[model samples]
Target: METLEGAELCFPQLLNTSCRKPLQHHAETIFLYILLSCISLLTVVLNLLVIISISHFRQLHTSTNLLLLSLAVADFLVGLLLMPLQILLIGGCWFLESFMCGLFYYASFILTSASVGNMVLISVDRYVAICDPLCYPTKVTQKRVQISICLCWVCSVLYNGVILNAFLKHPDRYNTCYGECVVVIGFITGAVDVILTFIGPIAVIILLYMKVFVVAVSQARAMRSHIAAVTLQGSVSVTAKKSERKAARTLGVVVVMFLICFCPYFYPSLVGQDMSTSVAFSIFGVWLLYCNSCLNPVIYAFFYPWFRKSIKLIVTLQILQPDSCYAHIL
Candidate 1:
């Protein structure tokens, strides 16, 4: 009886303090491991390809792609660092030290906030390109976009630091047993975080996309009406408008998907409950949110011809050739 009980504890030596292992079927555990492993691997590969594509091809280094590169970097870190840790967590044990637990949650919050920031930036970029096309080149310069990306990351780090200050100072504060890792935010902080990180950004993205949609429709109709009267210069203008509209549509899909993935994660806050990582619903929400990182690159491959072309070059190892950065991707 003693040996059997000992085997069930996370730390057999510290039986009184250690958490008991979760009761999971052996086959079920194997299945979950395989399924999650595949998702993690896929997320890593897809985001890595996006990073390589945008970074390697000079033609792909426009201001818009820069936002995508920032997003991919966040998602890549999610797969490389967070997902594996989450996978290990499936057995309901925290093998690492308390300090490492604090760092893990810190990194998670930073990446999540950064992703939200990037999405908001992408929406604004599309709004400028589609609604104010003539002024977009001057208004949204590469230097400006670079500065925006840096601020997004820096702000994410600082913002999450403030929110998680207490948790960071004492990572083991809420742990009920020796092997558990969890964070529990106060209701007020969670409410503020939801509004700042989820609600406010989502509202902005939707409003911007709504205006973009309206403008795109009007532009499409005008282009069709003027199709017969198009001279060489007029045709060029129409082509540019079409390109901008297509980009808006593609990014609109991305924003919609982002909302779908993120909505559940913030539901507890929406309902005026404290955000606690120990809750089953919160665990599910976190994984769903993480899955969004996997989906973003897939969306790019589906909608953007340049991404597909870049993937082909990368897979064929043609990117290894000299001066490959100058290859025409667009």
Candidate 2:
């Protein structure tokens, strides 16, 4: 009986200071490992494609795709870094040092916050383009959008540093055993995190999209009425504008999916509790959140013809040819 119990401990040699392994069936564990491994791989591949498509294609170097590029970067890191670490945690125990544990959560919060920030920027960009098309060219220039993205990422790093300050200062303060890795925020700090990261950003996203939808419907009606009266050049411009709106609508779906995946993870904080990754439900919530990174490219950007073309070029190694970047994708 003692030997069996020792076998279940994460570090059998450190009996008293090791966490017990989670009681999971062998088949179930194998299934979960395979499933999450696929998610992580898909997330990495899809986001990498988005990154390559936007970075290599000159036509896609617009203010909007810049935001998407930032988002894909974040999602790419999720698959490359966070998802693997999480899979390790979910397996049984955190074999890494406590300091690494704190660093992991710190990086996770920064990426998650950056993703949210990018969504808000995307929403604002769409809102301006749809509701105030004339001013969009002046207001949402590439330089301005690039600056906004830089600030978003900088702010995310700084904000998470503040939120995770305690953990940074004392990495193992929350650990109960050598094999355990955990992060705990106080109720007040967790509430603050929820308000800033979840509530406020979500409010801005929903409101902007709401206004964009109303204005988009009205514009569609106006365009339809004016279609016959417009000249050829004017008609071309209108078509281009319509295409912009279509892209916005696609990204809006991405934002909604992000909210759907994240809300459940933050619900415990809404109910006045710190997020605990040790529990089964919390781990499930975290994985669900990470899965969003995998879906964004497929659901939001992969449908574009230009994206398909870019992928073909990339796969065939044609992108390395002379002036490939100058090749018209759109």
Candidate 3:
């Protein structure tokens, strides 16, 4: 009944409920609209470039790097497909007519499910490498890693499919506005998603990482044993041990990023989902999730010497070759 421009006008009142001081509705709407659009487009394009650079370069195609590439690709798709339309919605311009809405949201939801699942898998991979060093190679072979990646997609599809169908508009109830309500359907769907996406995966990741971190520490102590056992072999053993530590540290960053990027997406369910409240909370979630696209490259750049070397090598060769600008010189 009452139109309070958009998220801006409503946000302050939301924080200070008693104050009831509304924002300049139109100005806030316009600013939010522009902000979302710029962020969406910019992040989308950057992630695509990152994916291409990784794929096109031979030196950057290790198993771990491949997993990172998949993450960037998935997040890039979320930014490109979902965020731009969400920006339009924030501007009160919902261009996805009734037909396309379900399909678009379905793709976005499924891919996001896959993305979180993959994060869990990546943690497991790193955990195995750090904790069970002897078995890591035999257990996580190239074939095994590929199979795990495929299983991630499979799990995402089945999990989201059941949940989506549970909320699907029944043909029998389609005509009755009084009996068939979308909000009730939305509440059920959101609750299920919150459990599968956040609760389940969060539990698994924490348990696995705890094991991994503890093992990493123990192994670090074990390095001292190498000094007396084989003084000449100490250098090789230490190098291997350092690599193991670095992988664990990278996984720590991955866990923190996943938690920060995705927690907002689940907050609406944790709080009571009054329509207006849910609207702002959901938008914040989407924006935070979109922000994750820019972080992987940055984290890798700062923390991963191997990844930095690969990126630098790729860039250097581009300047060296005219026709084959993408090829590495070495």
Candidate 4:
């Protein structure tokens, strides 16, 4: 009986202090690990493709694609780092040191926050492109977009640093036993994080996209009404309008998916409860949010012809040819 009990402890030698292993069946454990490992690998490969396509193809370099590139980088790290650690967590033990646990969560928060910022930036980009096409070129230049991306990342790092300061300083503060890692946020702090990281950004995204939708619909109606009277200049204007409307629709789907994946994760904070990683719902929420990173690249592949074209070039080794960067992707 003693030996059996010891076998169930995460650290058998430290029986009194160690956490008991979670009661999972052997086959169930193996299946979960395999499934999650495949997802992590898929997320990494897909996001890496997005990163390569945008960075290598000269024609793919636009203000909007730059924002996507930033998002892909964040998602890529999620798959490469966070997903693996999360897989370890499914075994119900923290094999690494306390400091590493803190670093893992800190990096997770930074990547998550940066993703929110990038979505907001994408919504704003589509808004301007659709609503005020005449001034979009001057207003949303590549230099300005680059500056905004930099600010987005810097602010995410600083904001999450402040939010997780206490946890970082003492990663084992809330642990119940050895082999466990957890973080608990006080109610006030959790509420503030929800507002800053979730609510405020979500509001901005929905509002901007709402305006984009209205304007796009109106423009479509006007173009259809006057289709017969289109001169060469009018035809060019109509074509540009069609392009903007299509972009708005595609990005609208992305924003909606972001909201769906993120809302449940923030529900506890929204309800004025303290956020704790030890809860079952929190674990489910975190995985759902991480799954969004994988989904984004799939969405791009479905909607963007340029991404498909670039994938073919990349897979066929055509990208290794001289001046392949100049290949027509758009």
| lDDT of each residue in 146-198, candidate 3, tens digit only | 77778888888787667656334442222121111122236666777777787
Per-residue error for 93 in candidate 3, Å, reads 3.8
Tens digit of per-residue lDDT, candidate 1, span 1-330: 445464688888886789878778999889978988898899999999999999999999899999999999999999999999888778888999999899999999999999999999999999999887767888999999999999999999999999999999999999999989988888989989999999899999999999999989988887678643556533437678888888888888888888999899888899998887753653489889989999999999999999999999999999999999999999
TM-score of decoy 2: 0.94
Candidate 2, residues 1-330: lDDT per residue as tens digits?
Answer: 445454688888987778888778999888988999999999999899999999998988999999999999999999999999998987669898888888999999999999999999999999988877667888999999999999999999999999999899888888887787888888988999999999999999999999988877877887888753455533436777788779878988898899999988898899998777675864668988999999898885555788888888998999999999998898
Ranking by lDDT: 1, 4, 2, 3
TM-score of each candidate structure, all chains considered together:
0.95, 0.94, 0.76, 0.95
Q: Could you tell me the TM-score of candidate 3?
A: 0.76
Clashes of 3: 0
Which residue runs does candidate 1 get wrong by more than 4 Å?
1-7, 227-236
Q: Evaluate model 1: give its lDDT.
A: 0.90
Q: How does candidate 3 score on lDDT? A: 0.65
Q: For model 4, how does the per-residue alpha-carbon lDDT over 158-241 read when each residue is reduced to its tens digit?
A: 999999999999999999999998988999899889989999999999999989989888888877787435565434466788
Q: Model 4, residue 77: what's the lDDT?
A: 100
Q: Candidate 3: which pairs clash?
A: none
Point out the worst 10-residue segment of candidate 1 by lDDT.
Answer: 227-236
